[model samples]
Target: MTNNKTILVVGGTGMLGKPVAQQLKVDGFNVRLLARNPEKAQKLLGDGFEIIKGDVDDPAALRSALTGVDGVHISLKGGPTEADFDHMDHIATRDIAQAAKELGVGRVTILSAYAVSEEKADTPESRSKLKGEAALKSSGVPYTIFRASWFMETLPMFVQGKSISLIGNQIHPLHWIAAEDYARMVSKSYQTDETLNKELYIFGPEAFTMGEAMKIYAEYAGVKVAPISIQMLAVLGALTFNTEWKGMAVLMKHYENWGEDGSPDEANHLLGAPATTLKEWCNKRYSQPVNS
Candidate 1:
């Protein structure tokens, strides 16, 4: 494996992907984004990096993206059905892995969720992520898979009419990491040999229950805090049955049965730095003007 400074980041235009690409560029790597709109990506990334016009699902596009790229970073947002997961998360990642391997790319890193390994509570999203991880592993390409906890950025979206929806009444330890901190971890993973062939369960420096987290956010946003009961959650689940809503319903059911809980000690030890705390992230993010 010869050293090539160029790295290709799939899904680089997404919420999590944007920060990873930015950090890689700042770290002096020749960062290239495989996006549908190269012009838009170039505009977002400024003049520092390149953007290859392509879709991850297109084999030809992936092959072109792999050319002259040393390493590859993959992160995908989940879709609703099994077919959606199959095409986007599983099949797309497999294509990227296969292309990167054939092209002699040195490393491949995947951003996955912490609960993907729980077979008892598997959803289409989790199953798809596992497939993606397996694809990279089976390709014989050195890989790093990050199973991260919830993103702190998603908290605001749950705020509706002064109430935060809860899957259940039980309070569970939720280890929430900021997208920026996660991106930093991903960039660092690409820089060292230490993370090769590793499946890391990464998380935030702090843990909070759903109520505790929502209360903090409500206070910051100057809104009264209240939790939607399990009965109401059931009603909402029944009312909205589309792909996105259906997926959330399934996940919420899983959380009701099992809890979102973890410790970041090992991940922090490996990364050599602590992640941003929930309070810190909320304060910083909320202080700024909310995105339209």
Candidate 2:
């Protein structure tokens, strides 16, 4: 069924992009990844796939990178200037969109965010994503946007001093996901039309509060722990981050209030299966046999 279709994976050298690119290869599609340094895609090499050296924002590089590509996968993360987001998102997305169209790419799948809304249309992260989404649509290519929640891996942040931290009561809901799930789904979308021309919100099966997530982590670690609250602005400043651990901090800001969605039903649509629930996640991920 593959017919050796060439799928161009932009940012395939990234945390999510690399996994998605790897999965695409597993599913029998010809993979072409875009990288600033083709060597960075080192792990993805030697599989008969091609790595086109370039940056997403560079036209000459992108034009060459996109040659003969049937579909495009964009997993872009804005830079520091996106801390104010307004100028970065749309412009970069526009560039990518224009390139895809010129290359005659037929389908485009953009990995987006779950809580991104029109109101926060100005937050550097949210706005940038929205712009990316707009760019894809405006480009006139068939598209799919995977709006995802927080990944389960960042659980380490809540666990400082080998103990999980808490904000407010331990009852605030937490929206979670695994990066692998997003990668697989995005890769799968290319092979199936079920996800075509739509913006899908993907999530794990259940919701855990900051307190609940930490509690599970603690229970898994089987250590003494308690819930505590911190000032919102301070937490915001740290979570929104301007330092080395900025990624973790940025993620925390989104989860600071269990995200913007209360219902975890988004997974029922695009993926057609219940996302992994908190209990299931805890048992498999954290609350294992301790030695696990």
Compare the candidates by lDDT and give the number of the best one: 1
lDDT for model 2, please.
0.68
For model 1, the superposed segments whose C-alpha errors exceed 4 Å read: 1-4, 229-241, 260-263, 288-292
Q: What is the C-alpha RMSD, rounded to one decimal, of candidate 2?
A: 4.0
Tens digit of lDDT per residue, candidate 2, span 49-105?
A: 698877766778888877888898877766545553444456766777788888788
TM-score for each predicted model, relative to the true structure = 0.89, 0.79
RMSD to the native, candidate 1? Answer: 3.5
TM-score of 2: 0.79
Candidate 1, TM-score vs. the true structure? 0.89
Q: Which lDDT value does model 2 have at 119? A: 62
lDDT of 1 by residue, 106-141 (tens): 999988877766463377777787787778789988
Question: Whose TM-score is greatest here?
Answer: 1
